[model samples]
Target: MFCNQCEQTAKGTGCTKVGVCGKQPDVAALQDLLIYALQGLSLVTAQARAKGVSDAAVNRFINEGVFSTLTNVDFDPARFQVLINEAVAHREAIKLRAGLTVDNPAATFTPAATLEGLVAQGEQHGISEALEAHEDLRSLKQILIYGLKGVAAYADHAAILGHEDESVYEFVQRALVKSLENLGVDELVGLCMECGQINLKAMELLDGGNTGTYGHPVPTEVPLGPKKGKAILVSGHDLKDLGLLLEQTAGKGISIYTHGEMLPCHGYPELKKHPHFHGHYGTAWQNQQKEFSEFPGAILMTTNCIQKPVESYKGNIFTTGLVGWPGVTHVGKDFSTVIEKALEMPGFAADEDKGSVLTGFARNAVLGVADKVIAAVKSGDIRHFFLVAGCDGAKPGRNYYTEFVEKVPQDCIVLTLACGKFRFFDKKLGDIGGIPRLLDIGQCNDAYSAIQIASALAGAFGCGVNDLPLSMVLSWYEQKAVAILLTLLSLGIKGIRLGPTLPAFITPTVLNVLVENFDIKPLTTPDEDLKAILG
Candidate 1:
């Protein structure tokens, strides 16, 4: 088995024997097969669009298909197998109406896969195609593929909120089709940029859906303690799901605490108003294996960055919306399974004081104070704005982000979102004109919020996002980070710095394309990078 679709790919090259993420060879092949099947489904979905089919069901297929392939999102073979079957079924259903034959895609595991059954094989070898492809070609293809995964994850969250963007689905399918072939670098690169373009629209739709549904998020302090009695820790990047859980558990004695990417949920006005919503627990996604072990409550993963579970207290963990683990409880659309599991956990201490941590300041909430922000800028009270955002992962150099945040000039404002902020989210960066520099925007999906705030600031300054004395020093660990990077490039944002490391899958040629078009550079150090960015 060979896999290198994440920050921890073995040796900074590829994971050849087994995934360092604990994904075995068979699991890797199954994931590839799942992507293969999704491409077929995407072909059908794309064709259906040509024939003018407009239904949430088709869009749902695209959303889920792309979503299921994101890095560290889903690891259940049963669930992966189910999605493959569902894709085949959906492809046929759409093709029957379109009068198409709907043959299986060129790159799939056949029923001959029957003998292998994935579980029994446990350690499958990588396909020669994936294992032996030219590194640049593979890298570019992976970029496109991974970017779509991010798009799908974001689309799924919005679909739950009843906000479905058909354009996003259509693009996801089309991009998947491109990845399923020997498409030349030029064509693949075009599709990669298009992924960026469409992602912008997709993000805008999600932004509208979130603010429209939850009202604009406002800055609020989130408690950082385990409330006395029953509590559940909600992780990953789905605000709508967290909101629903908050509503359902409001007075039922089940307290909700945000974990990882969900840490920013505390700032949303609608969600913060809930009496039972406690506070953030733990720092970032990477620390979960240790942090979760000590927590007494159940954990619910709504999306990505989930490592394989540990033996102790494994059953207390539950997942939904494309996040799956082999032994963890799988919650359906209703979340009853998660709620039920939370009730069964060892639970909390009697009379325990709830902890508090501050959050919110998402795009809308921050923009609501645009006038004040503008005034602060004019007064030179806020000399610089740093958009330090992206995903989190288990990597050594990631400490750079924490160090960088700690080293930021006091007059600057650090606006962050996604799990990466955990590097410094708890640092208490103080304030400039009564506003804390360490402002947490919602989830990774709320990368859109950071974009919105950046764009608004640019407009206020009569400049483009890149020209606003703002630097986007980002760290990417997964596919969702891919989507956000594409969105930034799509907007022609320039001179942004990205690091801990470059994706092993990214070829020098594709990297050049990104550099030539977007002027993105790798991160060096706080002193060096800050000087380059701020000077």
Candidate 2:
């Protein structure tokens, strides 16, 4: 299988048999085939563009197809097989129209209908095709590829909200074509930075789409406990699917609770105003196996981070928006079946009182109180601002994030996003001048919010973003975090403390480039790192 696109890769190297995330060898092979097919599709699309023809449909399909290959996102080989066939069909149609004769294997390759044949085909196109024994070129190529996966995920989300950026689509095609070229280490490294720049624009489009559609998120307290009666738990990062379920179940008895990345939905005023929208149900994605089983009602996973389900809860798991399990139900815009299942089961029995945590400090929420925050900083009431964010994982060293947040000075503010905040999200960090010391931003996509807030602060303080008293202590588990890190590096942001461990795919030579140019370092003890940042 040879998948190492995530933090949980086996032995910090590669997953060659079964994926640590429970992806089978066949499924991994299908994912590789699907990626290979997309590169072919990219070739066709790039040629089509040269002829003054661009297919938004092909662009959107490319985004969704690449996103499905992300670790822990989709494990359904059948789905990938279908996507592969579709990619071939799309490329053939586009090539016929463009009247171009490209000799790329990805463009003309034929797949066998049998699983073994598909696997054989994929073996030829796996990431090892980069074959740069030179190490640096290989590493940069891998980084660029992974960064595109993150871009696809974010761009897919924006597409759901009816937002499309043509320039970003062109960049995706051009970069994918770069993979076919034997580019030098320097050129591939430049391509990686360009991916970061494009990812920033992609994220900005997503932020606009989300806020424009859902309204700017507002600070609100989300219950840590469940509500009584029939319920449906919504997970993943798709707010559109969650909103549809909420609407369909509103007048009915079904109550909806956000899980994992969906936890931030409560801060959106449009969603929070729903009477049946109960609070967040769990900590983060990693804990879902146990939490999903314990929930009494039906579950709907809208996007990625779905683990292999246990038998006890397998039947209750329904997927939508490209997420699938072998036997789980995959639904469409209509969520009637999910609601019926929720009604058939026991939900909560009775409401529990587990207190609450504040969330929704997205860009608008934070910038709304910009004056107060600026005054606090000027008066030294808030001495430092730490952007502690990124994806969370089950690794042992992750405790450093919790411990670091635990020891932050009372006067500092911790602005966090993504599931990583779950480490200290429930902790009471108090507030400075009515601004909560611990600000919960939205999902990982909302890293744009953190960046915007920092830039605004820098402008107000008459200094560069690096000159501000802020440090980004990040923990990454998947490709989206990689893309975000690239964006930060592209901005020339420095001294980022990243952990629990570095990506297995990053070669030492590439690591040296990152360290020398970005001042990136691994996380240290809470006390020691805090002293270094605050000193």
lDDT against true structure, model 1: 0.77
Model 1, residue 23: distance off in Å is: 1.5
Give the per-residue lDDT digits (tens) of candidate 1, residues 154-242.
Answer: 77777777777667877888887777667777887788889988877777777777778877777787766666778789888788779
Over 1-535, each residue of candidate 2 has an lDDT whose tens digit, in order, gives 6888899889999999898889998888788888888988899899889899888899999999999998778888778888999999999889888887889887888878877788778876777753466667777888999999999999999999998899999998899888877899789878888999999999999988888888899989989987788889999999889888888998998789988889889988778888999888888888999999899999999889898999989999999988888988999999999988998898888879999999999988899999999999899899998888999888788999999999998999999999999998899878887889999988998989999999999999999999999999999999999999999999989999999899998989889989999999988788989988877
Which ten residues in a row are the worst by lDDT in model 2?
126-135
RMSD list, candidates in order? 2.6, 1.0
Off by over 4 Å in 2: none
Name the best candidate (by TM-score). 2
Q: What is the TM-score of each predicted model, taking all chains together? A: 0.93, 0.99
TM-score of 2: 0.99
| Residue pairs in candidate 2 whose N, alpha carbon or C atoms collide under 3 angstroms | none
